[model samples]
Target: MNATVNPLLVPDPATDHILGPADARVTLIEYGDFECPSCAQAAPAVKIMRDHFGRQVRFVFRHFPLREVHPHAELAAEAAEAAGAQGKFWPFHDLLFAHQHRLGEAHLRDHAQQVGLDMARYENEMRDHVYLQRVQEQMQVADQLRVRATPSFYLNGAFVDVSFGLAHLQQAIEQALAKG
Candidate 1:
C-alpha cells in the first residue's frame, strides 16, 4: 500500500533540518532519535542516499527522542537544537550519532566544541528547555503517525517504511524519482 505524507509532517524551514535543498522534487523526512542505535546505523545510509540523489532530493531530520527507552535521547536532541542556534546543527547531529554511547552532559559539551559552537551559549541553551517545544511538537507528529520507533521515513510526503535501511529507501526514492 502506498502511504501519503500527512501535511502536518511536512518540514518547516524554520524548525526542521533539511540536509539537502528544501525545494527538491523528492523530499524524505525521517523522525529519528540521536541516541538510537538503529538511527546511528541508518545515518550513513541516509548520507549515501543524499550523495546519490544530490539536488534531486530533500532530506529532513526531525527529533523523535524516545525518552522512556533512551534517557539521554532528549538531551541529545536538545544538544543538536542548541547547536542549530549557532548554525552547527548538522555537525552536532552527525557527532551525536557518531558517538551515541558517549552522550552525557560532558560529552554533549564536547560535541558542541567539536561542531565549533559557542560552548557558553550551547551550554546555557542546552540546560534550558529552549528547543524542547519544537522537539515535543515533532514527537507529537510521530505519535499522530502512530510511529513507535526510530528511523521512520516519509518520501515525497508518503510513509515509505517503519524502519531505516538503504535498500528500502533507495527503492522507494528510485520509484519516486521515476514518477517525478
Candidate 2:
C-alpha cells in the first residue's frame, strides 16, 4: 500500500496459481477479483508483462473478490478455482475478465465449459462450493497484507502500485528485473 514498501504476506508457491517458470528471478503476484474493472484492465497488461519478461518473471494470481461491490465476483472466483481444479485456471480467468459484465451463474457455467472442464465435475464442485474456502483463505491473506483493492501487485516481494496506470507496473517489473 505504501508504494513498493509492503512485502507479500504469503508468497507460497505450492498453493498459488503460477504462470512462468518456478525458478524465475522476479516473482509477480496479483491479488485480484474477477469482476473488478481495474483487474480486468490489468489482465491484458499481465499477459503483456509475461510475454515481455519471458521466463524472467513468474506471475501468481490470488483471489481477492470484493464482494461488497461485485456481487457475482465471489462465485466467479469459486468458479475459477473449479476450472483450476481441471487445469484451466488461466483460460477461465481470461474468459471471466473478457466478459466481466456477464458473471452470472449461467455465464460461469458457460465459461467453465469454454475452458473444457468436465461439466459434471465442475457443476458438482461448484454446487458443493468445494473451492470456497480456498478462495476465502486467499482473500484473508490479501486482507492480512492490507490489500484494499483488486489487482494489488507485488513484484519480487515488494508492492507495485498500479493505481495511476499499468505503466507503473511495467516500470516496476523493469526495475525489478534490473535489480537482479
Candidate 3:
C-alpha cells in the first residue's frame, strides 16, 4: 500500500468481470460500490465509455463495498459474486446498479431471480456466504491500491485521475486506447 509506488490492477481469472472482447488492446478496471451514489450515478457513463470504445477496450469491475456507509453494499457485492457462480454476473451487476435505490436482501434476491438465476442455488449461496472470498480479495487489492472512493477506475493499469461525467472519462479512454 505504498503511496510512493503506483498500484495497478492485476489480471486474474478469479475476480476480473471483463465486459468486452478478451483480447482488447485497452483494459479498464473499476473498483466500485453498488450502493454508493456516485457509483450509481456513473454507471451509465461507464456504459457509454464501453460503447464508445467498442471492441478496442475491455472493462472489469471489482467490488470495494464501504459497509459503514452503505450497509447493503457488501451483501450486494457478494450477491453479484454469487450470481457469477451461476454464470450471470454481468446481468446481476447491471441489475444492482440499475436498482441501487432498492438494495435490500429481499431486493437482491428478487434481482437474482430477475436475472434468471436458480433460486434454490441463489438462496443457498447467500445463506452459505459463498463468494465472499472473492469480494474480500478484491477489497484487499483496493486497500493496497489506496482506493478510498467509489466509482474509481484504472485504465490500462493507471488510476484515472480525471473529472466527472462522460467527456472526461471518454477522453481518458481515448487516451488509453491511443497510447496502447
Candidate 4:
C-alpha cells in the first residue's frame, strides 16, 4: 500500500517557498521563530535529518514569528523574505538561526553582508514595507494551521505528536518513510 500524499509538498503558494522534491517520501513543514530558543535548539536536529534523509525528504520553513515575546522576530522573518527576493533566502535563514541571540537591525545588516549579498540592495529591500506584509501572510497561515508555539512541525501534513526534539523528528521521519 502507498501513503497518502499532499500536493502541497512541493511549493506552498501561501509562503512562496519550495520543498526539496515533489516526490520526496518525507516532507517536514516547520513553523518557527528566529529568536525562539527551542527553534534554535532544533536547528542541529533538522540538519541531521537533512543529512540522513538527503533527497528522500524535503523541508519547508514557515514564518510564525512570535512578536509578543521576540520583538525582532517579525523583522527577522521580513529579512529572510527580502533576501529571498535576491535568491539568498536559505543563507539568510541559516544566519538568522545561527545568530539567534543577536538579532537586531544592525545584526541583520551584518548577516546580509556576511551572506555576500549586496548591502545596498539588501538594505533597500529590508526597508520596503511590502516584503514585511508577505511575512505577515505566512504568520496567518501558521495561525490557521493551529501552530501555537515556536518549533512546531507537521510531518507530511500531520502534526508531529511529540516534543520538538531531534529524536522525535527522526522518529517522525521514519514513520513518514514507512507510510511512503
Q: Write the per-residue lDDT of candidate 1 for residues 19-137, one digit (tens) a residue.
A: 77856878888989998989999998889889999999988999999999999999889888998888888888888888999988899888788778887777777777798888898
What CA RMSD would you report for each candidate? 2.4, 3.0, 3.2, 2.5
- Each candidate structure's count of clashing pairs: 1, 0, 0, 0
Error of 4 at 30 (Å): 0.4
Higher-lDDT candidate among 2 and 4?
Answer: 2
Tens-digit per-residue lDDT, 1-180, candidate 4: 125644433346456655477678777888889999889888777877888889898788888899999999999898888778778888888889999987899999888888888778788878876588888877877777777988988787777854735687788789778776
TM-score of each: 0.93, 0.93, 0.91, 0.90
Which residue ranges in model 4 land beyond 4 Å of their true spot? Answer: 1-10
Flag regions of model 1 displaced more than 4 Å: 1-5, 162-164
lDDT of 3 at 47: 88
| Each prediction's whole-model lDDT (CA) | 0.84, 0.88, 0.84, 0.79
Please write out the lDDT profile of model 3 over residues 105-140, one tens digit for every residue: 999999998999999989998998988888898999
111: Cα error in model 2, Å: 0.9
TM-score pick, better of 2 and 3: 2
Local lDDT at 159 for model 3: 83
List model 2 lDDT by residue over 40-149, tens digit each.
Answer: 99899889989999999888999999999999999999999999888999999999999999999999998888889999999999999999999999988888889999
